[model samples]
Target: GDPGLHHLILDVTQNGVTDHYQLLLGVRRDLPDRLLHVEIGGTSGDPGLREGPDVPEAHLYDAAHDPDLTRILLDDLAAEASVGPLRFRHTAGAGIRTDLTSLPITAEQSNTSLLFGDAYICKLFRRLSTGVNLDLEVNLALTRGDCTHVPAVLGWIELEPGRGARAGGNGEPVTLALLSDYLHTGADGWSLAIASVRDWFAHTPPAGDDEWAELDASAAGGDFAAEAERLGAATAEVHRALADAFGVTTLPAAEVHAMAARMNAELTGTCRAVPGLAPHAKALTGAFLDLAAQAGPLPVQRVHGDYHLGQVLRTESGWTLLDFEGEPARTQHERRALAHPLRDVAGMLRSFEYAARYLIAKSGTVPPEPGGRLETRAHAWAARNRAAFCRGYAAAGGADPAAHSVLIRAFEFEKAIYEVRYEAQNRPAWLPVPLTSLAHLAT
Candidate 1:
């Protein structure tokens, strides 16, 4: 019987750029005030304007995927034999788990009901791979490896029953969502970054303030370096674990150079769109080329496809990662592209720049540091973390640090160029986040 998932509650808000359908849903009370709660895209279209998330990625009863093979699945779900008053899947993580056959096939478009309880996070897959899904794969790996920081894989539902966890299901897993213990999280990477920058803006160091306190208090005395160091180490472990699972190969000089060429071309065009990013773009691209030219290319590993602080969680237990969706917009091939692990390092470094500038923009005032200090600080922090990340990375290295350093710098430049376009389109106020990198790159 379908897990009786009855009574869906929905509440949604408009997307930032357009009132268009980016319908977002999340536990309102469980989240911070500034966090933009979202439903990934239940129904994400103007309706009159276009198609969207609220509509469901794939039909509920996909013949190719769904096990019961019909809408009957929904009915069977509601009608599951009753186990007294308790919901059949009541033990399921978060939200209302209903007996499918009981009442109706209800599909919620939005709700405040979720906001009333612990957050129920749904893992939305950008690319559904063959075999055991990566979510299940990682959970299994974590369990086998005895990793504790990651969310426990309480259980997962086979949205398309026959499709998931089945030998015959091959390439058809209905990667809907998983049932893991919800993260009663203290903060996400972005939130912490915003908090850290707020402190910096207030003339306080990241380590001076208590991050767990009231926002104002944290700003008065912020201290994020410890967290930063921990995050770096955690990321290293994650990569090491991944490498243990999937072996790595050394990158070819031709392949590394090819990527550098693509990056350079991308920056050339991207910088022109926003003059502010031009100087930074040039420098960033130059650094990467310089590194590649010298290093003869390093070994390639199965690195985090889209690694970044935003992809992490910060808890007392330590920092952890969420989402293996990879670049979100890139092709599966691109996301899985093997290069210097520095690609991940560079991504995190870019995030610091993103975070620092994002808070300043939100506050509508620049940091107190004048002249090159702001850029210098951005560089210092990025350099510190990059170095810290490298220290851990070096331990796992197939190559030495001095040689990998050049390759990493190049990736950092490449990542920054992507940021320039991202900021120009989505956050003009933060266009400088990438622009800042571009500026540093230019000089």
Candidate 2:
């Protein structure tokens, strides 16, 4: 092997504990090797090199961010070439140049995305899973269906299963990365919403109750009502495309009851995990009970399992949704399973609540003294945007989310329960955000 970029799978042992790791290293013939990146769980399902005294200490190198290496990788994919155990798959469409410079998008948490000269973005999955990734699968489907709400899928990279080693116990290739057209002018919905909230907050003075009562989100300069509505429409369009591509199904009464039971079980488990939720558990459980009582069959189809403000982008043309992988904490089978589209609507509504109250949460202050001016303005902002979003969804040929109040409320409670567990374990400070929502539901 020549000195350049290399990917190694290693079984590292420390203090009698062993773990698999994937390391992307930069190597040189005459100089010390460099470690570009490392993933805790190695993508390779095969046994790898064991750590020993002979292991070498490597220097650091940024291989994915290197323009030359990125170009080479793109060229390989364009040529449909197999380099070692890796296979490149390119979609037939517009040709992507291999001469562009590449830089890493640093804001990502679960994956690494490299932007290539504003023309394309390549997302490299950190953890490898058998079967095609949901993001790649859904994006490709949307692209084939001519859905304009998503960026075009250029191609993807995969790791071929090694001989005599079934990929993660199944004889399937593992998806490594996805390449897509980059929206150069796209602004993320989160940033836009935060700015809108900031503007609204500035307009709202920290004054007496009378002045706060007059504060209106629509009157604020950075009102997000219009954008939120358009986003809703765009979301409906994408859902339609998904339903067309991957057929829809109806969950019968039994299944619907089972779904509600699952939600109840989750709520109970979460309350047990976080005792602060105990006071509101009885009230929250009623939403699920109402859901279980529905006699009608409910429609289910592929949905953006994890929909939120951060998952959307506002470009010059309109709203573009990103990341179809769903909730990262869920199993692959669960994420791929069909669910009610209102599940996504509920996710977005919860996001509106987060955006409206995030500034207050960030300030480390108690939730605006429970009905103070700040609290009033936050509620108004969230309510306005939530209504606008539902209006846009209904206007765009989708069922009005508000029309299915029972399902919507149940889903929102389910999402909030998940959030409660997550914040309690990871971020105690942010726990108040979901707690506040739970309180409102309880009342």
Candidate 3:
């Protein structure tokens, strides 16, 4: 059976003139179930096949182990030829550019990342957007600023609609793929933190060793306080560089109140959506409201909206930050908005708590006393690292995140509420991770 009429109407505004165009896609019974072939402008272009229905029918380009597709795209760009409605553009740095090499391509949630034989990693964004891509823009800015905390940009692929074809208004070019330096030896921060926690949890204090029992997180064999501090310093350095690159703005009280209002709304909705959050709603709301009554204006700048252990990497030099795309679920407009730097600080703090609680929940051993002994150790580890991170941040050129305790607490509470919903929908068994953080925040 042929899949019925698929009509895609795009309103294109070019040269101050707006016009509507339609694309009709009819299924080919002979093709695979996941494939979609496009037809537009009363002429059937190449029946380019796509694997998934979720993927956009137009702009179907795949370079995974297919040297032919790579050559086609590159040749199209070189010859300025139009392959159906898709147009290709490429840019190179000052150095000589390398020819396309066949390598493995890995698909992430929102994009496809390909390794170009250790020379570069090319990320092809799954979804299309009208404006400039943040990943490319941020990497370019950071590289120009000589910020060593991020990878250098190599080149990218930009796409624009062909003659009479309309995707977004104005027929403006959109970044479809980004090429950048790949860190071969870098280990993600989350994996390192998890390993450290597992190692520390497996260790047993010697018999009758009262000193070892009383020792805190810093004295443990897998103590992460030093690394946490260094990561903190690196975070602060990146924040400083971002501020210098993109000028900072002052957030007024009205904006603060509006942010609090949004937090309250989200908490209210989450409490209704997840029955487990009902008990802590009042306390969390109190924290959110506290942000509104703050004394003065807060400093705002472009920030990594979703700062977590997974977003950073620990390389030989130090902590290197990656993925400036902010939250994957957020809109491009929302992700680009200026925010308080402490928001990122708060996010990192919440990440530490998550790592600790996750380890404790996954641990097989349980103490006989049943008085939350494992939970206590996890909390201690989190607290020590949190404090060390704050100290290092202050030692760097940034203000102490602890100084804005109310704001940080509010952000942490908000993040926990979000995690609660995420776990409820995705991993119900891990619901305890965020719930524990909510319980502590309530206190």
Q: Top model by lDDT, which number?
A: 2
Each candidate structure's TM-score, on Cα atoms with residue i matched to residue i, is 0.64, 0.88, 0.78
Q: What's model 3's overall lDDT?
A: 0.70
lDDT per model vs. reference? 0.52, 0.80, 0.70
lDDT for each residue of candidate 2 in 1-443, tens digit (9 for 90 to 100) = 23357765445669995433344554332332222342222212322331344534333344665565567778987888898888898888757678888888878488878998889999987665556789999999999999999999999987776621333415666677899999999999999998998888777464567766766688889999999999999999999999999989998989889999999999889988999988888888998999988847988999999999999999999999999998988888889889989999999999999988898889743335555556677888888899999999889988887689899999999999999998999889999888876665566
Q: List the residue pairs that clash in candidate 3.
A: none
How many residue pairs in model 1 have overlapping backbones?
A: 49
Off by over 4 Å in 3: 1-62, 71-92, 96-102, 105-108, 161-172, 206-215, 360-370
Candidate order by decreasing TM-score: 2, 3, 1
lDDT score for residue 140 of model 2: 94
The local lDDT score (0 to 100) that residue 275 gets in candidate 2 is: 93
Query: What global local distance difference test value does model 2 have?
Result: 0.80
Give the per-residue lDDT digits (tens) of candidate 1, residues 1-443.
Answer: 12111211122335642111111122221222222222222222335322343432211111211212222222322343232221222122323333221111123322111110243333323223433455555654664565665666543433343433322234454433344445665478877866766565566434422431222222335656656767767777777776776677877677767777888888788768867775455467667678557645456776666777767888778787765546755654576566566677778877776765565455545645544455544554554544555555555442334565667677777777777777787668776566665555456
**Candidate 1 Cα misplacement greater than 4 A, ranges:** 1-120, 124-140, 158-170, 204-220, 295-297, 363-403
Name the weakest run of 10 consecutive residues (lDDT summed) in model 3: 34-43
lDDT (Cα, 0-100) at 69 in candidate 3: 36
- Pick by TM-score: which candidate is best? 2
